[model samples]
Target: MEKISVFLDDYRKAPDGYVLAETMDECISLLYSFDIEHLSLDHDLLHKTRNGFMLVQLMIKEKLFAKRITIHSANSVGGKAMYNLLKQAQRDLILSDSTIVSLRPLPLHFFPANVMKHYLEVI
Candidate 1:
């Protein structure tokens, strides 16, 4: 079966065409076990915890990935910082359209139904 890995502390609504993985470990395992075509990350996983960063680094080191990654983070300061960190890693990123793109080439994409479809087709 096709799988999409998600690095998150909680399981909320999936933005269509994606699946959810409860923990970072589960996310990685899914990537190792299935054809993960996409990934979704939540920035403030535990507010003060750096699990989000750790998960991304692990994926980078393991070379486990989907074709694209999207961030569904809180629109808070910490969230932006976390998003920035991911961009520095040079991962292809998708962000909500409300956010302004500061980093180049990483692809700050928008969310919601239509934009998501466009992103899937483009990437």
Candidate 2:
């Protein structure tokens, strides 16, 4: 089976070769349905029931994680919290040092448009 990449964001376009999930439920469903190789998450989904932070918590509790994960959230506080939680989960799970995981907060100017386009084109 070919593992896929997941991009979880409400208002951004997914990168090439990645599947997009606009809501926390959709993200969780995709995670359950696919063997995710890479996962990029975003916080603050306008008026959603759950956000990226919730997804990270679920992933940790269920012991479900991608081979590589990235947080591309613009919300600094939430993004940092998510990053911390994921790092803790990685430690608890004893993921290898080879695993590629990171928190990449985009600049304040990049949101819902330019940054998404740039990242989609580059990645």
TM-scores for candidates 1 onward, in order = 0.58, 0.80
Question: Which sections of candidate 2 miss by over 4 Å?
Answer: 94-98, 107-123
- Clash statistics: count for each candidate: 0, 0
lDDT for each residue of candidate 2 in 6-53, tens digit (9 for 90 to 100): 988887777778899989889888888889888888988865648889
TM-score, candidate 1, is 0.58
Task: Give per-model CA RMSD.
Answer: 7.5, 3.6
Indicate the residue-level lDDT of 85 in model 2.
86
| Top candidate when judged by lDDT against the true structure | 2
Which regions of candidate 1 deviate over 4 angstroms? 1-11, 46-50, 91-122
Clashes of 1: 0
- For candidate 1, write residues 1-93 as lDDT tens digits: 765544354535555555666566667778788875556666444434545556767765666556666655554554565557556555444
